[model samples]
Target chain A: MHLEEFAEGNSFIHKLDPRVKFLTVIPSVFAIAAMKTIAAPIAALIVCLILVILSRLDLKKLIIRLITVNVFIFFLWIFLPFSYPGEAFFQIGNLIATKEGLLHVLSITLKSNAIVLLTIVILGTSEVFSLSHALIHLKLPRKLVLLFFFFYRYITVMHDEYVKMKKAILIRCFKPKSNLHTYKTYAYLIGMLIIRSFERSQRIYNAMLCRGFKNNFPIISHFELKKIDIAFGIAMIIIFFSLIAVFENTFTQVPIWIYQKTLALVGQASRLS
Target chain B: MHISEGVLSPAVLIAGALLTAGGVAIGLKKMDYNKIPGVAVLSSTFFVASLIHIPVGPVSSHLILNGLVGILLGWMAFPSILVALFLQALLFQFGGLTTLGVNTLIMSAPAVIAFYLFSYLIKRGNNIITIVAGFLSGAVGVGLAGLFMGLSLLGTGEEFVNIVKLVIAAHIPVMLIEGLITAFCVVFLKRVKPEIVGA
Candidate 1:
C-alpha cells in the first residue's frame, strides 16, 4: 500500500509535471486497450519497460507489483483458453485450448502489464497530494479533489486503527474457527471499528472547525510543464499512433492472406478428385 | 470484483465514467460541510475494509461494507465509494485507472439501491426488524454489486447468464458474511448510539 515510495527520486521521469505524465499515460493506456493486434500491446509493454528503467524504480518492488497485477491475468488464461471457441491449438485429455483464446489471454496480459508498468513509472513517481493538485489544475471538481486529499491523509490512520482492534481481539485469545462464534466475533470487531471511526470523525470535525476550516483545500505548489515534458508527450503520441497504424495494417492483411491460401488449397483438392 | 484495464470496451468505459461523474456530483451537492469529516472517515474505513478478512465457515472473505456505507450515508455513498476506490487503485492496484468509472458504478450503484430499499426499514422498525433489514440490505447490496460486475463484463463477449451465475455464486458466501456483520453493527448502534443511525 506504499504507493508513493518512489516519489522521492530525482530522475527525469520524476521531474516531469504530474499533469503531463497523467495525460500521456492515460492515453497510452487507452491506446493499448484499443489495440486489435498483439504486436501493439507488445510494443507498448517494451515502451513501459524502458520507462521503468529510466525511472530507476527498485527492481524488487517492481517485480512484486507486477506479480500482483499478473495474478488475475494468470487466472484468465486458465479459463479463457478453454471457453472461447476457435481453432484448437492443443488438447489435453478433454480440454481444448483455442488459438483465439490464447490470443485473448496474451492481449490482456500484455495490455495490463504495459499499463501497470507505465503507471508505476509515471504516477508512482509523484506524490498523491501533487497528483490531486494536478487534477485540480486540470479543472476537476473541487469537492472530488478534497475527497482525494482526505482519503489519502487518513487511509493509513484508519488502517492502523483496524490493526489495533485486531490485535486486541488476538490478545483475548480469539481463535478463528468455522463456527458461529467466530463469525459473530468478526462481526462485532467490524462493528466496533466502524463505531470508533465514526466517533473519531466527529472529534476530527470539531477540531477542524476550531481551526477555521473551510471546504477548500489550500494549494501550495504549482506545476510548470518543462520542455522535456512537452517532448515526452509528443514522443508518446507519435509512437502510439505509429504502432496502431503498423499493427492494424499487419493484422488486417494476415487474415486475407490466410483466406486466399485456404481457397487455393480447397480448389486444388477438388480439381484432383 | 475489480475489473482490470483493457477488459472493457471504450464505449462501456466512457459510459461508466459519465454516469459515475454524475453520481459523484449529486453526492457532493447533497453532502453537508459538517458531514465531510464523517464521509472522509468512512471512506478511509472502506479503503481498509477490503483488507479485513472475515472468517465464513471454511473460507475467509474480505469485507466490502458498501451496504453499511449506503444505509449510513445515502447519496453520499457515491463520492465515498469513489475516493475509496481511487485510493485502492493507487495503493494496491486492485482496479485500474482506466476502469475506475466501471468499478465505481459496479460497487456504489448497488449501495445506493440498498439505501433506498432498506434504510427506511432500519430507521422506523424495532430492534429485531432493524437487524433483519440491515442483513437484507447488506446481502442485497453485495448481490446487486455482483450482478453489476457481471454486466460490466458483457463487453467481453461472455454470455450474460453464465457470467451472472458465476459472479453471484462466488459472492454468495460474502453476502451472508456481510449480512451478519452489517446486522450486528446496526443492532449495536441502535442500542448505544441510536441518533447516529439516523433512526
Candidate 2:
C-alpha cells in the first residue's frame, strides 16, 4: 500500500546529487549513534527537524507515517527500563527503579528516534533511484544493486496482488475462528504469494532473454555530480562536526516531565540537608 | 528486529559492516549472475512477508522468513537479506544504517545454517521433516538474533541476559508460525514450482 503512493518528482532534496546526500547520511547516522551523552542526539534531532522543514513535506502526513512505525518501537523502549536491572534512583511502592535504567532507556529511545527522523529526512526528500546509485557508488556489488532495482520495480506489482487477494478474501467473508485456522490461512497465503512471485520471476527472466539476455542490467546513465553536490557535501560535514564539537559534553535537559521530576527530587534533597 | 543506527557502538557497527561485506564477498564469488533474479524475487518475498501480520491476542506479530530465503537461496541470502534490510531501514525505518550489518547477520546466519542442514531433509517426501526443519530454522534464527542483540546491549551500558530473554520470549510464537509456514510453503513449492525451491 505504501509503495503505490511513492511519488516521483524534481523536488530540491531529490534534485541534489545523490552521492552528497548519501555520504552525508552515513556520518550523520554515525554521529547520532556515537553520542554517549544526550546533547548530540538532541542537536541531531534539531537538525532532523530543520531538514524536515526544508524538505517542505506536509508535517501532519510525515508525523502520521512515522508515528505508525514508532508506536511499535516505543512499546519496547518504554518497557525496557522497568524490566531491566540497574542502580536504583529511588523506590515507588514495591518497585525499585534506577535513574541509570531510565537514562539507558531514554538514550535508546532518543537514538532510535534520531535515526528514524534522519531516514525520513533522507528518503522523504530523495528518489529511490538516487539512493540505489549511491549504494552502487559506495561499492556494493552490482548484483546487489540490481537486485534492489528489480525488487523495488516489482514490489508495487506484488503489493497490488496482495491487496487484491486480501480484498477477495474479505469479499468472500473468509474469517478464521482459531489461531490454528488463522495460521493455516496465512501459511496458504504465503504459499500462494510465493508461487505467484516465482511465476512472475520466470516471466521477467523470459522477457529479459527475449530483448537481450545478458548478465548485466543496463545502468541508468544520467547522474553527473556538479558544483552543487560538492558544496552540499562540504556544508554537511562542517555543520555536523561543528555541532558535535560545541555541544558534545552538555547535559541534555530531559523532556519536561522528567525535568520536573528531577527538579522535585533536587528540592527534596536540599530540604533534607 | 532491526537495530537502528544509534542503537550500536561505532566499533561494533563498523566491524559488522566489514564482516558482513566479507561474507557478502565470499557469497558472491561463488554465485552466478543468472541466479540474481531468483535472489531478487526471494528478497521481494521477504519484504512482502514482513508486511503480513497475524494477530496474537491484542497485538500482532509479523513473519520474517529469513530461514525460507536461506533454505532456497543458500549463501546468497546474505546479500539478499542485506538489500532487503537496508531498504526496509530506509523506507519503513524498520532498521537503521548503522546496525544494518549486525541485523543482516543476525537474520542471515541461521538461514545459511538451515540451508545446509535441512537441504537433505527435503528428500524422502517427509513433510514432517521439512516442517520441523523450517520451525527449528526460524526459531533458531530469531533466537540467535535476540541473543546477539542482547549482547550488543552490553555496549549500550545496559543489562544483557534479561534483554535477551525479553526479545526471545516475545518472538516465540512468531517463530513457531514462521517455521510451519516455511515448511508448508516449501512443500507447496515442491508440488507446483519445484524449480524455485532448488529441488
Candidate 3:
C-alpha cells in the first residue's frame, strides 16, 4: 500500500541497515522461490508472519491485503489439480481430483502469500528514499537508478491523472453500452493518456535542458552499516541457511497440517479395522 | 507471462540466465546515446501500457507489448525488458526472483523475432502494415510462450495438459486485447511522433 505506514518504527528489524535489509530480502525470496511443496510454503508463511510481527507493522492490514490476493488466486488453485494429472486421490461427486492437485494449489497459494508478505515487511519498514539510496550505493548502475526514480515519480502522477479522468467520465454521465463499448472507452482513455503524457514529457525534457540537466540523475545516501546491522545480517543469513540445510525435510515434506488431517483419517480407518 | 522458479528446470534456469546476460551486454553495446530520451519515453509508455485493461469475459487481461518494445528498441528491448521484469519481480512479485532469466527469455524471444519482421515491413514503406505486424507479432509471441509453457509442463505428466489447456484458453482473449492495444499505441505514436517508428 503506502510507505508511510512503516515509517518511524522502533523495531529491531526496522533498525537493520538498508543494505542488509536489501540483501536479506533477495536471498530469502530466492529460497522461498525454490520451494516446490506445500510444506515449505506454509513454513515460509509462518516465518513471514513472525517477521511481520518483528517489524511491528499493522499485521491486520497486512493480512487483509494478503488475503485479497489469495482470494484472487483461489480460483487458479481450484482448477489446477483437476487439470493437472497426478495420482488420483479420490472422487468428488462425478469429478476426480488428486491429492496432488489440492496440495499443488495449496503450495502456490502459500508461496505467493509469503512473497507478498515479505515485500510488505521490507518496503513497509524501510523508507522509500532510503531504499533507493541503498540501491544506488549497492552499485546498481546510474541508469537503472534514474529509471526507478522516474518510475516512482510518474506513477503517482499517473494515478492522479487516472483519478481525474475517472471523475471526468463520471461528470459526463458516460456509461458503457456493453463490454465492447467499455473496451473502446478503455482504449480511448489509454490513447488519450499516452498523448497527454507524451506532451508533458516534452515539456519536462525541455525544462530540464533549459536548467542544464545532465545525462545522469543524482541521489545522496547517508546510511552507515554499524556493528548491530552487521550482526543482524549475519544472524539472518545463518538462520536462513540452517533452515535450508538441516530443516530440508520439514521444509520439503508434506505440510504438518495436511499430515495431521491424513493421520486422522488413517486413525479412523484403523479403528474400523 | 511470468514464470515462477519451481515451474522451470534448474538447467533451463541457468541457461536462460547466461543468455539473458549476453543479450543485455549486446543491447548495451549498440544502444545510441542520443536515443536515451526516446528510450525513456518508450519505457514509460510500456510501464503505463500494462495498466490499461482489456475485458476478457468476466476477467480482464493487460498487454505485454514485447513486440512493440522490440520494434522501438530492437535488440535493446532485451535490457529494457530485463530491467522491467527485475523491478516487477521485486516490487510486484509478478515473477520469481531466481526465475527472472526464464521469464525474460519466455517473454522477449517473441519481441526479438517481431523486431526483425516489422523492420522488414518498415523498409518497404508500408507503415500501416508495419504497425499491424508489430501488433500481431507481440500477440503471437505471447501465444508461442504459452505453447512453450504448456510443452514444458507436458513433460511433467498428463495432468499438466489440462493446466496448459486452461492457460492457453485464458490467454486467447488476452492475446486479442494485447494486439489491439499494441496497434492503438503504435498508431498514436505514429501520428504524434512519427520519428519513434521511423528508424
Poorest 10 consecutive residues by lDDT, candidate 1 chain A: A1-10
TM-score of chain A of each: 0.87, 0.79, 0.79
lDDT of 2 at B186: 73
TM-score of each: 0.91, 0.86, 0.80
| Candidate 3 DockQ, CA atoms | 0.28
Q: Report each candidate's C-alpha RMSD, comma-separated, in the order given.
A: 6.4, 8.4, 8.7
Shift of residue A167 alpha carbon in model 2, Å: 3.6
Task: Report the C-alpha lDDT of model 2 over A1-273, residue by residue, as the tens digit.
Answer: 565222344456657777777888888777777776667667777887887777666677667767766764565554565656768776767666667667766776677787777776766466677678777878777877888877777777777777778888878887744377677677767778878887888888888889996756467576788887788778767776677777763234436668899999999999999
DockQ of each: 0.51, 0.48, 0.28
Classified by CAPRI criteria, candidate 3 counts as acceptable
Give the lDDT of residue B128 in candidate 2: 78
On the 0 to 100 scale, the lDDT of residue A49 in model 1 is: 88
In terms of docking quality, model 1 is: medium
Point to the candidate with the largest DockQ: 1
* Fraction of true interface contacts that also occur in model 1: 0.58
Q: Which candidate is the best by lDDT?
A: 1
Candidate 3 per-residue lDDT, tens place, A1-273, comes to 132455568887777778888887777766765566666677778878888888888767666656655654655565666765568877767677877787876766777777777766765576656676788878875555555555455655655666688689869886643265565566556656666665666677787788887866554647788998888777766755555555466453548868899999999999999
